[model samples]
Target: MLAPPLAAGELERPLVGQSEAVILSLCTRGNRLPHLMCCISIDEIDSLAPRRDEDSSEGKVAKISVLLSVLEGIKDVPNLMFFSATNRLHMMDEAFLRRMSGKFFVGRPSSEARKRILDKARNALNPKILKKLVVATTNFSGAALR
Candidate 1:
């Protein structure tokens, strides 16, 4: 929906079916997309841009093309950034990966990392118990520990 434009009276109604035009305008035209952070999560990498063999819908392919173009276009624009987090890296399509300028892997914490994590939370536990807990939490995330 065109919530932003509709509120500002740019358009009388939402541009329901003009996705490509809208995306292109947002990327290439004026300061329609503000200079800010855009963090997103696509849980199923395969679903968005599945392997060509696994995808048959023309709409999906078209969507992939449009999305890639928009992302690739505005990547160098100052003060604009997109942060996407996905756990299913292996399932991501090659085109999606190719569009990414940098890729970082955040795996489970190592022993030193775990120790540092525990050091901040050692007030409630004995030293021996903290050591045991750190070892036992070998694969837990920072959020899980918190």
Candidate 2:
């Protein structure tokens, strides 16, 4: 899971948890079928603001090039299904984002969706209280709901 920091102007490295590394290693080693599946969860992509440096453009470009090379190496291995989830789609790098061409944008739920979701959650609550809680969480995301 790539839990990018929520604060603006915070430059932090992407966090790759242990489980993610193990899965990637398995796929790279040919122990697991590379074409089967790969999953990534990235939260708050919009918060990944680039570092501000007048003379660092070349450095940033070089770093991006290195990352691209690594991605290319992975792509050469057929059968991997890369799944990435991000709330801030607009914050991604154009070049890197392009690789995920057929992207799906899942935004905040509408009032109707909230109603349906409340109906589903109602099973665990008293009917009167469920409606109140759902109404309070008007713009909550699915993750927040969970």
Candidate 3:
């Protein structure tokens, strides 16, 4: 599941209607460049790593096993790097956390940071309007501000 999208973009690109085998060979072997893998909105990871007692299906177990196997056997795939994001982290399963090499918590921005963003946006308003925008956008991300 995680591996497919890594090559999806490359394969989807219009390379004069190249075959999947040719594209895979080019991405995995033709060049020496590293493959950048990313998976966003990873909130459903618990379903992927469901507990044995929690109505886990055979298909889920198989997928989880394959994902873990791929993650564990990183050496087999040359220069493979992965990243993921999630908004609902409290619901995450402990077993999945153990497999992660690192984790980062990007919380809400500070007042000063918000002000700087507003400044970059060049909002030609007085203090009151600026303050309102900043305070109202408590949990808003930088991208959302634009």
Candidate 4:
């Protein structure tokens, strides 16, 4: 069987306690479907792998070491892929950053998108208030709007 997609915030606990196993599972294939591909998406990557110099706790350091080892072991697995995102790229480990194949920036939501976001609460907010909120929330992220 192919690995299931891991959504944002889903891997936090496992990444602290069982990171190696979690990563290894991404590259495994069920005997009945050996050709199936796997994908793993990790959000807030900086939380899981902060810079070694900034956080030197024994557990944190050990977890990162194990995570890097598992990733290295799976580097040649053609059927496996990873996508990770972080708002604090500067706070992330340099070694972990090196392992990423590419990076992209996603800016704050546009005015139209922000309007739609406020529209979700149309029942709670009067039309006048919603319009004001949309204009007031310029450059806000979707999460911040929520």
The models' CA-based lDDT, in order, is 0.58, 0.50, 0.53, 0.69
Write the residue-wise lDDT of candidate 4 on 1-146 in tens digits.
34554543454453455654554454443222448655666777777788997549765676566557555543345555667888899989889778777889999998889989878856588878888998999998898898
- Candidate 4 regions exceeding 4 Å error are 1-18, 26-34, 72-75, 123-129
In candidate 3, position 134 carries an lDDT of: 86
CA lDDT of 115 in candidate 2? 64
Return the candidate ranking by TM-score, descending: 4, 1, 3, 2
Please name the candidate that would achieve the greatest TM-score relative to the true structure. Answer: 4
Clashes per candidate, residues 3 or more apart or on different chains? 0, 2, 0, 0
Rank by lDDT (best first): 4, 1, 3, 2
Q: Across residues 34-76, which tens digit of lDDT does each residue of candidate 3 receive? A: 4554232233455445454467655544544544544455423
TM-score of every candidate: 0.59, 0.50, 0.54, 0.71
* Backbone-clash count (model 2): 2
| lDDT agreement of model 3 with the native | 0.53
TM-score of 3: 0.54
1 or 3, greater by TM-score: 1
> Which candidate achieves the best lDDT against the true structure?
4
Q: Can you write out model 2's per-residue Cα lDDT over 1-146, one digit (the tens) per residue?
A: 23432332232334534333433443354325544544333344333323324564554544444334334554244544344555556656666566554788678887667767777765677767776777888889765665
Worst 10 residues of 1 by lDDT: 3-12
Error of 2 at 33 (Å): 5.2
Which pairs clash inside model 4? none
